[model samples]
Target: MPNVVEPKLIAGNANQPLASAITRRMSIHRGVHIDLVDARVERFNDGEIFVEVFENVRGEDMFIIQSTSNPANDNLMELLIMADALRRSSASRVTAVIPYFGYARQDRRTKPRTPITAKLVANMLVESGISRVLTMDLHAAQIQGFFDIPVDNLYASPIFALDIREKFKDRMDEIMVVSPDVGGVARARELAKRINAPLSIVDKRREKPGEVAEMTVIGEVKDKICVMIDDMCDTAGTLCKAAELLLDYGAKEVHAYVTHGVLSGPAVERISNSVLKNLVITDTIAAPEPVKGCEQIRILPTAPLFAQAILNIWNGTSVSSLFETSTMEPIYEGVFRS
Candidate 1:
């Protein structure tokens, strides 16, 4: 609110809808309508990425919103290039606002020989001259340590908890939050605590990629409405399999609330045909047309959360306050349910 350096928002082609929504929320927070920076991002005939910042960004604080989803490499390259352009143009600071950090699943090596792509990506951003990084619900929390610069890893539990409260307020007692895999129990427990529901875990085994060997319900889900929570849902195999196991265990209904819906491969089709009643996801990654067409899939906007974080960062205030579930109301209720 005080007279200070105004931050300019520049969007990459990764997720324009989310970027636009963030800017709108930023406008309301600043009490004045703010516009996105004018920029052009195109590719040459040989598939070389090109970027041009038309307006002057010298001495300005710049926030580039880009999600490394779907075409992960291209989007990542665009972000790096944009940062390079802004830094070369004399921007005071560049903050890379990434909603869905791709390659995060490979934060560590599972086998004897494998690359830590998450750290590599972090190194790339830092080398590109980015002063800070802002991301949400990283696949692995430890990935924050991969970056030497300051990194803000925003959580989606508060947002998902609000939605769960509104949708199942009357059935809170009948609801049981579930973790599709042991790795996600912590995330699921956070939402369970917020909704005041019991927690359940799906003790599952994964033999290899895109496959679920076995899933056993670890808690009492019989006849209860089960809500599965995870950081990301890719291919939907694990979620769909877990839903089936829950139903088989007598769950009245099974739903999912995931942060990043990296619904690649047969995810859309699988969710549409799975036993899960509904699959609620955040707009961290842009949903494709087929995914949008699925009746069981729903997308929630995360702009308000990101916008608030950006505002706090610019004001030199604490960002952890944004993670407090009671700090904000359910502003995006019933907006993008499909």
Candidate 2:
């Protein structure tokens, strides 16, 4: 707080609701009220993005809150253009606070003639004059290495664990943290360690082309309240399929905790009909009407988590402490049934 100019926040059209929520949390955080930077983000008749800054941001700290969710390309462009404008306006430092980083799933090439889109995105953000980057639960952690600038990648496991503790207090011993597939074992293990629960893996494989993927639970999930963890849930095909498989294997109930709910295609419909109890997703990507109306889905606010991280970053405190603390209570609404 000692720096001459207070940090300024702005939003991209990708997720204005999330940006507004962060601003609200920042207002009362630590007895300090930070205002959103006055700006205009618009689109031209030809689909070209335009950004206009109304404030004199000379030597001021800037943070652009955007989630590169659906319409990833356009939202990504908005972030780049805003950073360029701030740099041209002489902002002291600019940090791109991306709640959901798109193109992260393609961190590596899976087949011949493929691209590492995640690294490409990292380079794009850096070239946009962003001095630093802050994001939550990237699809791949290794993507951080692609950025030459400082990248603060946060984890939602702590907050998720907080909700899990209270929700399953009675069935703590019967809880089993499950990784939907082999790729997410680490994420599942982290949550398992947090709540002192056993860990399990769902091994899925396809025997041939155009065939249903056969799944096998690697550990004892029979009679356990299976809690699956993953970074993102897109389409919901694999996630829902795994949930049904768990129930078929004799699990008492199944629940999921995913950071970014990209819920594209028939994801909402599938979750509504799936055997899972409920899907708890963060407010990273703005949810659409179908997603909101789905009774089987719930939302968890991540504003406090990001607000604390930003405050600590501005004050030059330990940002990692936010992840390590088990007792930090976040502001919440219990209606989501976390």
Candidate 3:
């Protein structure tokens, strides 16, 4: 934790909207005294990157806001350069604020001769002089352990859980939270416990990235409202396929609640045609225009949560209460549907 006064915020080209939202929530008037350096980035013909940060960050607490999402290599290079610049300018401390950490899904090597890119990303950050990391809803919790420096892995679940509680309160028993895969069973169970509902798991096999075949469900989802939960939604194949299977298995309705929406290539179209009633995602990573325009997709802001976390960490206060609940509360509490 450090002093809040004069905490300088820098941004790479990735997810500037999130940075701006965070700045707004902090009550810092845009562009008065504080500055957001746009690290100019360029890619060479060989696909190499070049970056330059044009601001002095000496003795200042620098928070670099960058989502290593689309064009991940370029954004990552921009962050590394900004950190290098801050360190060379003798900044007191550097905290890399990556809303959506790329390469997180590659936390483990499932096949022979594959590299663990998540650990490599951690090493790169440390080498870039990032003293600490501030990120949300990492693909794997173990990725935090990859860093020797202090890493703060924040959660968007509290925000989503609260919204779910507020939006769908009348039919608690009808709702069954589901994990799209076995890896997300823990996360889905946590949400189910919070909502005081039963949990289900979708047993699926991945033919390759973005292609999955859901075989069957492990719990009783028939005639129950199903809500699929996962850390990130990449191509949406797994989610959409799971939703289809849930429908085939007699699920009344299917909805998805995911932390990071890395909706690439065919994600939006896939979700558009799938059985999902709605897909709720957090504003950890910037949602493209297609995602925003999709009728079935919704974006929830994490600005308040991140702002509160930053304030708590700065004041040496506990953030324990934020992580306690797992259930989705009904939007209205008093009414009951018989």
In the order shown, the candidates' Cα RMSDs to the true structure are 1.9, 2.3, 4.4
Q: Is candidate 2 or candidate 3 better by TM-score?
A: 2
Which candidate has the highest TM-score of all? Answer: 1
Runs with alpha carbons beyond 4 Å of true place in candidate 2:
1-4, 206-212, 330-338
Using lDDT as the measure, the top candidate is 1
lDDT of 3 at 57: 63
Over 200-247, each residue of candidate 3 has an lDDT whose tens digit, in order, gives 999888677656643688998899989888999888877888898899
For residues 1-338, could you state the per-residue lDDT of candidate 1 as single tens digits? 88765789999999999999998988977888787899999999998999999999999989999999989999999999999999999999999999999999998988987899999999999999999999999998899999999999999998988888778878888999999888988898888888899999999887898777777888899989999999998889888989998999999999999999999888899999899899999999988899889999988879999998988888889888878787756444354343
- Across 1-338, the per-residue lDDT of candidate 2 in tens digits comes to 68455568988899888788887887876556776788999999999999999989998878999999889999999999999999999999999999999999889987799999989988989988998999999888898898999999999898788788878888899999999989899988988998999999999886652234688889988999999999999989889999999998899999999999999988898999999998999989999999999999988888888887887888888888877635355344352353
lDDT of each: 0.90, 0.88, 0.80
Q: Using alpha carbons, what is the TM-score of model 1?
A: 0.96
Poorly placed runs, candidate 3 (over 4 Å): 1-4, 28-55, 325-338
* Candidate 1 whole-model C-alpha lDDT, 0 to 1: 0.90
- Model 3 global lDDT (CA atoms, 0 to 1): 0.80
* Deviation from truth (RMSD, Å), model 2: 2.3
Q: Which residue pairs of candidate 2 clash?
A: none
Total clashes in model 3, counting residue pairs 3 or more apart in sequence or in different chains: 8
